[model samples]
Target: MSDIPLIHFLIVAAALFSIGLAIVVTKKNLIGILLGIELMLNAVNINLVAFSRHDPERLGGQLFALFVIVVAAAEITVALAIILRVYGQYGTVEPDKIDGLKH
Candidate 1:
């Protein structure tokens, strides 16, 4: 099998990050923003695992990527709960429309 170039992975990661950033910036829904954030984190994970491949012994980057995956999972759980609660209260997930809950 042919070896993949690091630049290829880097380019993909950069594209993912840019698309994610755009989603985060332009999307009105909180869930969409969360998805964008996930995309960005996945891009970073790709970079980490790709780099780790070069260091056959250490695998530190890959381990860190796993840690990140766990953290992201937990974050999604919490964020989704918050989003659902907000939706229940306000009938919407649009960030601009939320403006905090009243006392």
Candidate 2:
């Protein structure tokens, strides 16, 4: 298999960031926004892992990235719990429809 270039990684990261931003901006559902955030985080992880390939230390960026993954998982759990509670309080997950907390 051919080795992937740095430019290829950068291109993929940019695409992922753009898509995540678009989803976050256009999606009205709370869960959709959460998913977009997760996507962005994953894009960051890809960049980290790709760059870590060059580091002789080998544990620098990649180890931090593993911590990031754990933190992101915890964040998803908390966010999902909050979304579920909000859904139980309301009938929908649309962001604009959540007016109960506005006052």
Candidate 3:
């Protein structure tokens, strides 16, 4: 495998995290929020793998990244189910318009 500088990986991760944060903050749809969260998780994964590669004696970061990936997968399933249920009940996925719990 060709070697890559750590800083380059970190920069990419930071960019992904920033974009995901913006999407999470400004998006109205539940699915959009979920997508943002996934993006953020992927950014974290990238950092973890990059760090682990530099210290191959211990694979802690890589293992942790694997766990994060598994957790994100589970989160996607549950989040999509919740979003679908909310959309079914209200015919909308916009956060501001979802006020059914207040009643």
Candidate 4:
């Protein structure tokens, strides 16, 4: 079986990260931004796993990726909770329209 090149993994990861960044930058809704962040995290995981493949003895990269996944899950849970609260309080999910926390 032919091995896939590291460059190929890097390119895919880069593209995923870029798309995620664009989504985060252009999105107005809090949920959209959260989705973008998740994408970016997944991209990092892809890169980590790809590099880990080279060193079969040491599983550092894969270990780190697993940690990242756990953290991302926690982050998203908290983020969604915040979003839900914001939506309930303000009646809108758009960050720009939320204006003040005092209200």
Candidate 5:
């Protein structure tokens, strides 16, 4: 098999980021928005890993990616907890109808 090109990885990562952005912008459900955020985070991680391929040190990108992953995990936990509370209070997870915060 031929070695994968860096440009190919970059293009795929870009596509993923765009799709995630679209999902976040268009989705009306809280869970769907959360998933799109996760997908965008993953696309960032992919770009970091792919760039680390060129650098001999390779430490910077990998470290940044690790930080991103840890932050994403923390975000997911907190967001999920909030979403659960919202669901309990409102009986639905639609983002548009979550008007309790506006007051």
Candidate 6:
């Protein structure tokens, strides 16, 4: 069986992270930002899994990646709830237009 190189994994992770960052920066909608954040988290997970592949006994990197996934899931749930509430009150999801919270 042929094994893939570590560099390939690193390159893919970098690309995914860059795309996620770009989405976060360019998007104005709350959901779009959330999607970008998720993408970035997945990129991190990929890196973790890739590294963990080298040392199968420790499984540290894979464990950390699992933790990250759980946290990200919780974060998205809370974030979506907040976004819904904001949309309910303001009738829009654009962050810039929702200035009621500004103090």
TM-score of each candidate?
Answer: 0.95, 0.91, 0.95, 0.97, 0.91, 0.95
Clashes of each: 0, 0, 0, 0, 0, 0
Rate residue 60 of model 1 by lDDT: 97
Model 4 clashing residue pairs (backbone):
none
Better of 1 and 5 by lDDT: 1
Q: How high is the CA lDDT of each candidate model?
A: 0.94, 0.88, 0.95, 0.96, 0.91, 0.96
lDDT of 2: 0.88
User: Per-residue alpha-carbon lDDT of model 3 for 12-91, expressed as tens digits?
Assistant: 99999999999999998999999899999999999999999999899999999999999999999999999898888888
Give the per-residue lDDT of model 6 (tens digit) for 31-87: 999999999999999999999998889899999999999999999999999999999
Error of 5 at 96 (Å): 1.1
Off-target runs (Cα >4 Å) in candidate 4 are: none
Model 2: residue 96 alpha-carbon error in angstroms: 0.1
Better of 4 and 6 by TM-score: 4
Scored against the true structure, residue 72 in model 5 reaches a CA lDDT of: 99
**Cα lDDT for residue 70, candidate 5:** 100
Q: Is candidate 2 or candidate 3 better by lDDT?
A: 3
- Tens-digit lDDT string for candidate 4 (1-103): 6899999999999999999999999999999999999999999999999999999899999999999999999999999999999999999999999999786
**C-alpha-based local distance difference test score of model 4:** 0.96
Could you tell which candidate, 1 or 5, scores higher by TM-score?
1
User: Quick one: how many clashes does candidate 2 have?
Assistant: 0
Report lDDT (Cα) of residue 90, candidate 2.
88
True-vs-predicted CA distance for residue 52, candidate 6, Å: 0.4
